[model samples]
Target chain A: MPSHDRRLIGAALVLLCGVAAADTVYVTLEKDDAIAVIDGATGIRTRTARIGKRPRGIALAKDGKNLYVAASDSDAIQVIDAGTLNVTGTLPAGKDPETFAMDPDDRFLYVSNEDDGRVTVIDIAARKAVKEIPVGIEPEGIAVSPDGRWVVSTSETTNMAHWIDRAKLEVVDNTLVDPRPRAATFTADSRQLWVSSEIAGTVTVIDTETRQPLKTISFKIAGVTPEKVQPVGIRIDPARRYAYVALGPANRVAVVDAQKLEVKDYLLVGQRVWNLEFSPDFGRLYTTNGLSNDVSIIDLASHKVTKSVAVGSHPWGVAVRP
Target chain B: MTPALALKLLIRFNRLSACAGRILLSSGIVALALFQAAALGGPAPVRRQTPAPVAAPQAVERLTLAYLGQLAEAAAVRPYFEPVVADRGVQGARLGLVDDNTTGRFTRQEFALAETRLAPGDDAEAAFKRLVADGRRFILVDLKPEVLRRLAALPQAHDVLLLDVSSRDDALRGGDCASNVLHLLPSRAMRADALSQYLAKKKWTRWFLAVGPAPEDRLFADALKRSAKRFGMKIVAEKTWTHSFDDRKTPESEVPVFTQGSDYDLVLVADEAGSFGDILSYRTWLPRPVAGTQGLVPSAWHHTLEAWGAIQLQNRFRQQAGRWMTEADYGAWLAVRAIGEAATRTRSLEFEAIRSYLLSDGFALAGFKGVPLSFRRWDGQLRQPVLLVQERSLVAVAPVEGFAHPKNELDSLGYDEPETSCRAKP
Candidate 1:
């Protein structure tokens, strides 16, 4: 009640806030049912939290105050306080929320629920799943257009990608291709979308406006089976001139010419290179090699694997600090 | 010639000319025969009638080699399959892996849909069946166990010989074992036995414990314990870490501390969760080294596994994937290799034919597992020497100095048939 007491209470609150901020770290989704919070700078995993069955698909809110993780086994998205790494809330999205994309403004989030054959849209501020848009079978990758006008999801089973207008919450077009279209990344200027066909062992380039596959670039590596050169995750540099793809069984990343849609070269990485993350500045690309249980660091400037950091077993998902 | 004389003379002349001509012709014929004989030197030189082009030796056709796994996209198995495919006279080969979301983990959707959606329902089994039903005989599968099982059970695939190349789970080998599943990856028990025998040989008997929740992890732990017991080792301390919980302090502290000092010579943490096991190393209070899931780990393949004739395999895999070898990549590679070996040796892909050949005494597969690999008659698990590796390098192999089995060396490592809890037969 006294002024001095109020000051003491305020100081304690500030200290408590500082402690929470210090302890809060990046959350890493594990292959099984666990999420590990690793110090962003130290790289030491501070604590591991068990969430839904087979926890994966992690995304931080724009303000960095909250984190949403797909507890795949439980079929729900668990929201945690970014500062404390504690579950603050949860929302049921769809059958399996494997990967998702957030809008530029961070107001809307789109998720590719692989099992349900649908994309769930969530209102970030409302903390709720707003809509579920049906897609082709085995929808895996989801990406928002640079203008935030449309969302795109790739269906593995259908070997196609569906372009949806966020306002309409409807599938406007489908870009058909070979089997197992896993990942999709938009060019920097938003003129084209690059899709990786896992089963066909090729990368399909599509016109963003027409939503039609225009060019398909295929590479045949000797000794590598056509069945195993599955292309999974994909990303384009900010300049939009170069595209990098994670080749699954191939154990390499295919660098493509953005304009020509031709494969430039394959950069080698760890065994079973799965998901990947590029530094915000696009200087370093980090890839998770599931079977090897390691993270490969690729220096983009050199376009080669610079380091392989041993991480948890079955390193699944990866995220980097801005 | 006149009358008789002229006729005689003419006849003589004609006869002489005819005789001379006959002699010349005979000489020419003789010379030709001698040259021909010389040309056809040794045997009877039997010339059989030529057959049509269809009957000529068939040229090997290029194949599309498919690989299926959770992380099929990133594994280095391409190297192993690539060289084999090239050397085997395959005209061309294309490899395809299953697709996943950005994270390497397979969602329920990806796993389920992958079964039917990967190719058409006309996958290898269907294609093999259609080909077999139409009279084609051979088939090779480096597919997962469930897929292999499903395909083998199909009536269409019955006549089409199939080779099992993946899925290392021992149950698939011993009990639930498919008559057709020819595994490329050594069973978990084989690896456990490898480590167990090594520990026994080193006289490291006492073991501390940290077990995770998965049934597979427990099985591995049980195998380790079985090997320890067979080698006269003891499990002194045991602790369980339930998933989905967290503490600010280190979870490694859950292991009880004894004032009298630790009882075990090594701490074996069977944490397959992948998140916590690496931290268990060097964190244990014990003065000795750790084993099992972390510390000194036992695996079928490692990228740094260069010794014991594994350099070639390592080189091939690195060249293909541009990365070191992972256990799964090796497993997949072995599966494909097993099929190739069976296909080439037996010259048939008939399921029964390949199975019989693979089970025969002559079938030995050279995986990158440091030794010749084969299946046990009793359990059907691949008999292998497990590599005990530390810091990415192989430290030792199993069937340690003193641990001995009457029949096979791999038997020295895991639960013997006599002590077996797995009651299934091969």
Candidate 2:
């Protein structure tokens, strides 16, 4: 074979791989009733899809072919096609669907109906609610375990984290946490669950096996008062090495060493930061700032906020395509 | 004494004795009936005759609260300043009852508010006795200090929990403190201190103090003086305004003259009524900012506040009342919400249970403020964030960034435990 032909084949293979690895970031602009898509490499918004009224929570499908958003005011889950960025269908959800979590296999979606005090379980393919499990009052945070065996819903007013058995669709245990729990996340190993309490200014860690609180991590900055250090949205890295917590009025993200369970640093971000997401390689973190109406991107290696990109009014939820 | 007066006094004493005797008898009968039911494992006849259904609905617990106030004439202010409703306190209590019921529907609890408005010169003591006689244990009082003290001292009010939602006099929480009374309104000192904190943070240390002629204005001025000292501010000059100005007559010519001979960073007015304070803002002698009762006033609730889910509450109140919420309304609402929170947490509507739960350390009510509001153990005053608001916008919130306390930061805006003169009776 000719050497020029071999070089041309190598170039073609590299182009194909680059196209396959293309990434896009989706953010829910809560007040604008739209979801913005940003090009991952350039950090520029490429497209926006108007989904529904008060779009709050966003999650991508396992295959990265579709996006699901919890439209709180509309009380439905809007399904969007990733390729065209258009609303393809709507799934029946409970009253005031605020936040949700999808199973690892993308077969089922668990939603928190804040006003009705119930968790609606939906079959993704059928686009209908399968079961309504009653939880505590003002349920806002919803999470499913990595092993797809358990689901947790945190209620704001009732101050309880209810653990639901996935297969049975029943509440198996209830763990009381600090006041006004807003968000929850499960560790990669499925051994521990972390819930953030906005009014209590703490993150409660619970053991999945025993279903008991293992530790409570409180955040305190040198110049900020304790009441202002509200923990709202939390994200644990894929490797489970670090936990990033968005402190709502403090305008800072707390970096917690997950292994040691200690707060190592506070990265200054935009005002009223609430939700957080990470890049596919865990090299960058994105936080949605509700008050400042922007998103802050932080470089994971240096622990610094690299840039702040302006979005719509009250950006709340974010999802990244892998 | 004259024979006729002596005879009248004797008749009144006999009537009082008869009323007390009747109350004692009714309470004794209720206690006996409760004991009989408990002893028989239920109310005897029904339980013995038929077995109740396994899925019988549980008896819903009902919480009754009362709002008592005197129907005094509205303040003689300009027509533009007229309130939408003459009965502000009762409206707040009614809205609070609705909010409680909204949460209660899910908790198997119900709440009802009983409103009683007295005519001018009517006997508040008699009206309060009537409410207690009707078995209302929680009462929200919007009466004057003297009337409230009289009601609080009545023997029939010993078991009742009174929430004062209108009076801002510190004396009620200090020298005249009552064992059964809890204060929801921010005291004069708290408001003054809140303003002083914001002013100090802005570095507006020099103040020109202007006071009105009324006694309430004098009291407010005294509170401002104390706050200035506490916050390390200096009063550069002082004056007393003895003139009155109407809307038709502008203060453009006289205000500058009245505020002359002062080099100050800001002007602090102590006008309790809406007399001349509004005229001092842009008409100050010096090109300075104005604060206190006129310009940047400190209040418990303002329409400008839209944070911490307050917009939802404001919208609800507007829909129900068809007007903006006032400070008195917010105070009354907070009082009722405190009771609702206590009942929901303990799952019991018993008076003693709710009272003890409210006084416990675990009791904190989210009052749409940024932080959880709890009563100060020293004086039974609700500790909360005070907002510094202009006419159209929220300027800032109190307990400003650098103002720290050993315990809660809200303590910085009011009397601390050490400084509190209230020897609260247990």
Candidate 3:
């Protein structure tokens, strides 16, 4: 081998070692039909691994070794080995698992089957579906509370978010909102939940304890059509001072003042900005611009798009590892 | 009298008084107004419905779309080649027509002539702008990239979607893209990718490339390289061929210069400028087939592409243009379809509403690519299945055979979402 080739191999090996030690977040871009494993500290996609058909929602196991991806079209949950970056197993899931939630212990997964109007609870150990909890039509945006006490699922067609008690697997309360309630995120304290409405172009703040909508923040960009700007995903910053909402079709992400319920700024990313993730250190934010076929990286402190990295086509749903 | 009974009596008396005489009509109107004032339902004022204004069909009547200069002015109206043309026959509607003389260079003398024939006086750009501003949105053009780029950059075109059926450049699909422009041509990259995919499937992994001596020829070469890298194909050898080979006495010498006896699975030619790709095909001594810009090629609209409801489209084009529609013609047709479909769905020509309907999930378009094509949010490039064609027949399509995105099945063929470099609000 030439001396330069030897040097190149040595450098690659060192870089590989560095990657192995660094925290990694594996995100399944369901629409892109691939999983982008991002380096959490770097905010860059380290590698991309292919999975089952129409993969949508993704959940990290408690151990953070296995990533579960719900392939809606294939009607299965693909289990990806984080270390090997390979699809290890496939478990039968409900129809159109567009969104999913993971239990605290990671022993069970709650998958929102959008087409079938139900949530399937899968036993992680056995790799089989254990139970099905019926929900409203086109169920999306499934999120479990940090305490593992409640599971919330949004039904787009019905425009409501159902809060289910994890233990009982029964609906404790239902909060109604404007049309096309797509996604929701809970505060660290679990006292409040923020839900984004895809159709009405608004976000509703709900008190988890009261199970009622507290406030609604409606937003619009000048020169942009009000109807086309459908909000889809929500992610709270690590400091919990602000929230980022992905405005679909408008190609922007709205930064919200968490307490005031006001849009602080609209960060222009690319066409059809749908899902987002924060870097492990909380210094950077990465978003999947579905139409642009790229990921936009935002510097958290600067609140500006620092870089745009090219990725696969129709990138949807992003995750960052800590 | 009780208030309710008094009001009812007053209303009835007003109706009776109106019929009595003109003098009674004034008294009846006054009494009815008084009754209405007492019967006010709520704090909000009653709103009167205003009739919707009817949209007037445009004057300057038919917007004339000109094709690339390669087509003869009268050729667009000929029926012998109608079935292959995409936009020729739209209900036999007679519209103003223009001709674009397609030259390999950027000189706009002929374009100037076409504009003159359109009767563009002083300030032609202003005239074009005024026409578009007045809701005459239909415009067919076959100008080069720079010309189209300039036209799209005009403030007037912000509301007008410029359909590019002429240039097949891929850069316009993403980073270099303009917001108001919609590309009709399946990019050279897309076509090359489709061809490379077919070769990869056939296990023709190694290739000998012959580049033509032209600037655009390099684009084809670049596209092939990208496809080769993407599909795990390798470039084993390469050579350049001139348009004329008068000095070369033997074909063996030319083949040896390209291959040098190195084993390659295929010979990929890049001669879009039409140098020597046609002659190089099937002339390789290695017995392997030739593909790329010539030989077994990938194209958008082929005469033999009768599958996937293409026959209907072909028939329509034949009826309109009176000839066969080429790939570029199909691109223009698809662009029109996009606007038409969006406008029909929204029931308005308002830019915002139409743009919204186009961006929505349900806005799917069938464009003879076997499946519906949609815009990628990442780069706004329309993701349509590419047809790997040869001699007016399809060999395969990329997301060919086994390519599938775990979510988007069509994503398997070309660049998927994860591979994109676009970011907005991170």
Candidate 4:
């Protein structure tokens, strides 16, 4: 059926949508405990696959064959076959997996066990937890460098990012940031890391080489209240030129000049935008609006919210791939 | 969210500047340095030599904050639905130490909260002296307004920093306000104002006010009346309850009769004791929403508040305390974090430096309420957004849209600069 569905999707790509633009947008509905699959070409939700308890983080595989979701309450990573949209397998993620990052080789996934105050490194092929790294409490934002040399875990209560050396699997350094750091993202070359502090309304750009913060960028939208400006999910583009940040509750995605280290523009999205993902071509950005219960598709070319696809309740995390 | 559970990361601390030699930090009597380290039983922080570019460590400074609270004399009867949590407010102060230590790990600072709860007939003056002698100037207090006033008047408490965590008496922030103490929890007036804003937003302008027999209930009712007037809401029907309707017995019949004559958009019950608010919620004759002490209550913390990074604190508190964090606990937590923020922002251990920085306009505490909570220079009241919550869901956060002030929107909640008689500053 998986192979049959892949052939149908391939046929649909050629018959309806173009090959390069046939990106499948998968959004995890936190409240609904389901993944809403949308056809990127039309910005329309095609399927709703019921997966796991409290599904938040959704990551697409390298070959675009599987989608791994962090089912927090289930304490397991539910893997879904991309073609069939069926849960194929499970990976042992520790208690309450908030989010995770896949290594460059896609061999491992560093999952943040929020309640456990540890990051469980899962071996994809083995389907087992390989190592547990003790971090600060309420560890939320997790990232693995594209080179697979470093893994960064940002702890909310600790207000520090514990830098894990990929080789040694040991925490070598810690950088203090603003209070309640929610999410962290590394640039394409993995030279720079952007961390969003939810409470402080600021994002600290860390220098990956020196393991130090380069600049603390504070956000202030003209009409938005300062308290409402909470930065959560951050993602840099394929070109690594512009970084997009989901400002929680403010309902705006901040466009940051990654090279220049400045907030270029703010694309107004939906209420309580938690996480976002860039499409295969990086031509569009999909934001999971938690409160709005919708997926806002941002046309990257125009930097405007082009379409809002209602994906049911609490759309938390989004991922797209060809 | 929380500190690490120490696993092989044993951080050996060289107390660079130990202020107190021998001090009873806790009832268990922990070593001054290991107070917070052992209390949380979280991983001992491992400090690296490489310093971060921004907010780097100045030097390893040992600081201690103390908790001063009074045990409730009479066992307060909570309705059958509520679970009784002992050591409620103190747990919040304890969590604050854990939180401070989280930042303390990177800041090269160690923090401890000396807990002292006054039981029946305990000497407040002697306990205050002991904390002061132990170099514990910053104390988070959850006491009655009168008890707080008595402690602040003590000669030894002159230079000490006392944070009022629980007392919601507006008079304490007004005439009875002390320059030494900073109010972390919002006053009754502020809570009423927070609720009024939400009511105004919803156009629930007509209120059926129900007041319990308790003295605190009356005070809360007073606040509700004031807020109603301020928000341009009409108290169409006001009633005082003197009837002793046992919660075990059928209040269904009694409550409807009591509320039958009233026609209002919302039922505002000011019952400080969990006396009859629950009984009034669904049993109201009009089937209108009940707010205030029971239904959609305005509070510092709620079990349902998972937004604006509050989930981190909620998760941490549940993991550590094995219970939900209460409003009193949230107040205590904020006081401790305020101390840490003040200390970290100024980067000094000097009493005046920390105290002034706390009161200064520059000092802002990220209270996980989607805002930077700061002290009102006029009344020493911590300005913060109030949470309006129901049983299992967060309804709204107050200082609701369009409820604005020329200076600070949070100032619009409680007594403003001109409205207050407390002149903390010249």
Candidate 5:
């Protein structure tokens, strides 16, 4: 049989297995003002949807209908219809919105306005900002707790992770971490919160119950200097067994045991990896490589990079929809 | 309402506790309520329905820093270059104040810079006295070694912390180290060591040393010799350039003959004033590369540096100073930023608290050099990655790959803690 027919048969087999292979991975190209959509099964870029200028920190609606992208330069979040792959509306965000976290209930979005040093809380239903909670300087990373009771904003310059009370809409506590904190993620159990410090090259795990740091996991790779191992974006596996941290400029992702709070292995990926997302079924992981302008597909079962799909210029944020 | 009444009200409110009183006073809401009540002439009812005590107000702390330097009588110029007239060091301090205030606005801290530039023949002691009398406790010094030594020896110097941003003489960090002085600029030995590491990494071990006539040039050449010895490199040939030539009138006939005796991999120029080194790169007898003070110069900061978010700093400096940031500017900026970082981290403006925080393990500052910079305890020298840059581009950053240290890799490019002679501590 010819190679083309063999590939066709392989595709038919995958589809006939009842595997939901129509999932789409959306990657925000920061410099190109667009989002590249990639087919999850084929690992091929499907289309590019034009977004607001300098769009970063993408989040899909819980129902998988609308996609929200933080347009850093435009100071707004561009809402796109996931089915149509077209922008639906623009929601006001604070100045220089670099990252955001949508609440579990999908009623509110917490956007980290880096330059403004505040987190703008927006009502998803109203599509407008409702409150601005002051945080430490240069707030970048934002994560809402799994139970939707707390929101954490990591300030890069202040080196503090602010825990904001969802009910009070005020910063209740500030926990100092390593230098240049960039990303935050909560475990599936909602008991541990992991924050990545890009410059200090460490991931600080904070206990949600006590509001104290439980451990600081440091990364050291062979042949790579400590200064170059900058941990930026973090994503916890759906089963809460492993945590993947994107070590910027190290061109690798650190697989950390979520419960043990230790780095298990450093999986080599692409250059300057920034953000990551997992497939709906947790069978694969997608990472946006900023410098290499591509996305690495990691097969969760094998814990290795299976394929790399070229994306757009300086791809930064990623979102996956089933 | 009379000012006395307001003072009386505040004193009565202070009975709650100093911290609570401060919170109420700084909140601006209490004052607004008081004004409204006073306008309505009904203070009793308003006092009964006081709003619940909210979070503490953001209190602003003010810190004042001083810049002390001397204006040279004559601006130094290269053979045919423009005279350098601008006070680059002071400009950096000013930019530092701007940067600190920017972060300050959000952190409830205000920073102010007091600049004092002495004219020629001005008594340095008198200027120090005036600054001390003005209650300036932090000083950023951009002066020669002689002047710096004189200022450090003054009676009031003990009360002030001096950040040396200009001088690179090794003796200041070694034998003549002052208890009150912290060196921000990399010493000549550090620069030479950085270059030697790069040279060793490139396998260019043999070098021809060319020393200039000035005393500073001799010191730099001595540093180069020490670096070559430390890094296990060989100095193939050495010469002192004592002759001067007018670029327009001199012929190229003697250039090749003057450099012909050397059979080395690179020519190390020690001209600190840019007098003769600019003419040595392409004019060398051997087809070797030129480095040291001119060619592949090792500096604390360079215009071509764009890594570790340095481009943001460069853009900010250019926007404020209307020019590119120079090495001296970076040194001064680092000094002021060190103070800012300490103040922000410690949340105290006390000199001792800030000083201790700066020397402690908690004082890692992001200097846009790809690493968090800190100070060496043995000597008050800022440990940073030195950039080896050409005129137009960054060639490499020092403490090259594979060079390992038992402790910090940055120690590979400078005097490590074990070898330092200075014993100053906070």
Candidate 6:
């Protein structure tokens, strides 16, 4: 065996003993009603913290002290302490808090209230739902631009992304997308927005400057049919070279050339991959697979699925701590 | 009032409960905006911001849809079912209009539904002509088979797109199929085939068919028979429900004795009106699962469907109609959304352009069935997944995993192009 493989085994042992401080990957177990914590160093699930019912949409605080989880069935955004993996508090997120985008400064939690066709903005510090902004019908995927200038809510039925102006606190523009858009994200520089449409089997990238769609990238896998390639979670590399899209049920993560806006490769992963998160150094990508109840770890450099660590039932969203 | 405006009124009055969705997200704003909306005691008003306009704004293109249905349906209504809804077909169309208008709000296009309900014995042709005369090109007919057939026969309606939202006439998809008519909901044959496909995957080959006495029950039974034959299943024994005793009071002997002779893996009931199928679950002679109209049923939409962005439609319908969305409502909603999707994509106001776009291979509408549903060119029936739901939970979705088709997997659940007798031009 290579020395690299032996070093990985040694790191796995240290993680099994639960004694080291390394990059930690947090996964929301949508079915089992818990959050699975895995050591990024070893790619082994070290802990499963029972949280709330049908937890999804996880995010780590920039300070790395708090982890926010959208406990959808419970209808509350549950905050857990990163150090102890224990739920710290529940934020009043308004009915059915499914997917949420936190402010870069951690001031507000913009959650998509699916049943209401509105976005409920919860004040993180106050633990109260401060504002309810109506968007298109069946709003699901939500995003806050890195620069905090805009909040875009992707409505599934309306098939449009509502651009909410931060200062105005109302929808300033709407970018029409493909049907049943499931996920969305803003580029690190907040210059572009990428949305994945599950039903249309395509990813739409919008130029944030004009709030207009720049390109619509449709996926066509060799053996897999079009309908099966339902795009869900989208994550652009910090280096801005590649944008990874989680193809739900197709069990593949499509890697697109972010600069060129074209699908370059498809990396096979576990079943029903729903969401993706990057490791601290941007060296690895962790994905939560809903059907297989596991998280696939992909080495960014090699662009390969390196490991599949079994987590709780129906792992949905993934977050990482440095 | 436009459905879009009505929906806004509902949101202003209704405080919707937050629910969960399994998907992806980030940003936050100051608490000042909440204070602004808090004064209204409701959610902030959703302003439909039209795209950056021209110096002289072009007139908004308005598309009006006509809904035709009877105030009272002649079909048998179960005395024991949920309270009779006043707005069944129209409500669904109204919600569909709301969604279409929401999308249209950005494109400078406005969609409206002009709903018309006839009194008993009202002339169907008069209403159809009036709607067309009023410049309504997209008409959703929720009327009975005879009324619909009458409208389809008119020369004035030949060029117009007439949508069948509530009718379940299998023959309409066959000899009576119209060139301009399109179907949104699943027919009896499709529903039966959906149930049979799930049962086939489970290897449940024997079905003891207990058909009720209603004329509609017989029709449903015929579909069940065709589906059973198609799926290679056998009706080990068949019996007509002959009991006249009140099912609610006398649960002791009727179903058990009626179902006694058949030794089968499943007892399939064809009770269209909910006359006696509700009691057949535990009352069957043998310990077998029951399915068909009551015990476990196949439907296009249900309240419990949260996956594939269905909850969004269910929520919007509930908010607008103040009730659960039914099969009729879903069909009506799909019909309008279909027209809206075509119009939005093709950016055309003309009937031929939208209709031709709908018939083309490029058109597909996301109806929250976990798949993009499209109309079949041969029969004009919407190809969609059927939900096998037991009262409280979604049991399964059909076109089960292994079921395959040359064109699409959903085609396995209904009459394929080759099997359809729709002789109208494609």
- Could you tell me the C-alpha RMSD of candidate 5 in Å? 10.0
Give each model's whole-structure lDDT. Answer: 0.58, 0.81, 0.62, 0.80, 0.80, 0.81
Q: What is the CAPRI rating of model 1's predicted complex? A: incorrect
Interface RMSD of each: 30.2, 14.4, 22.9, 9.3, 10.6, 8.7
Q: After superposition, how far is residue A132 of candidate 3 from its true place, in Å?
A: 1.1
Candidate 1, backbone clash total:
32
Per-residue CA lDDT of model 5 for A15-116, tens digit only, reads 576554568999999999999999998899999978899998899999899999989888889899998878889888877687899998999999987655
Q: Model 3: per-residue lDDT, tens digit, B203-298?
A: 889998888787677877887888788888999987776646468545656754565568888888887754456556555776778888778877
Q: Higher DockQ: candidate 1 or 6?
A: 6
The worst-scoring run of ten residues by lDDT in candidate 4 chain B lies at: B1-10
Best-matching candidate per DockQ: 6
Q: Between prediction 3 and prediction 6, which has the larger TM-score? A: 6
TM-score of chain A of each: 0.84, 0.92, 0.89, 0.93, 0.93, 0.93
| DockQ-derived CAPRI band for the predicted complex in model 6 | acceptable
Candidate 4, residue B231: CA error in Å?
1.7
Off by over 4 Å in 4: A1-20, B1-60, B75-84, B243-262, B276-289, B309-312, B345-348, B360-366, B390-393, B401-412
> What is the CAPRI rating of model 4's predicted complex?
incorrect
Least lDDT summed over 10 consecutive residues: which range in candidate 5 chain A? Answer: A11-20
> Which is the better candidate, 2 or 5, if ranked by TM-score?
5
Worst 10 residues of 2 chain A by lDDT: A13-22
Residues B1-426 of candidate 5: C-alpha lDDT, one tens digit per residue: 333343233221101112322342344344333333332332232123222222355566777788887654432343434424365777777766655654554446677777777655667678778778889888888888888988888898888889998888988888788878888988999999999999999999999988988889999999999999998999998889766655653426554666788588998989887767877877778788899999999999988997665765787678767888877798898898889888877877888999888889778787778777888888888988899999799998988877887667888876777777776552
User: lDDT by residue for model 1 over A1-322, one digit each (tens)?
Assistant: 9866865665576456542132223435466466655543234566666666666677777777778777766777878776676788877677657788888798877888765567999887797888987675467888887866568898754456776756566664555665556778787666778887665567888877555678888877655644347787888887777888888757888888877777888888888777777765565677777777666777665576767766565666765545
RMSD of 3: 20.9
**Cα shift from native, residue A135, model 5 (Å):** 6.6
The share of true interface contacts that also appear in candidate 6 amounts to: 0.39
The number of clashing residue pairs in each candidate reads 32, 0, 60, 7, 0, 8
Per-candidate interface DockQ score: 0.01, 0.08, 0.02, 0.21, 0.19, 0.36
Off by over 4 Å in 6: A1-21, A126-130, B1-56, B71-77, B243-251
lDDT of 1: 0.58
Chain B of candidate 4 vs. true chain B, TM: 0.84
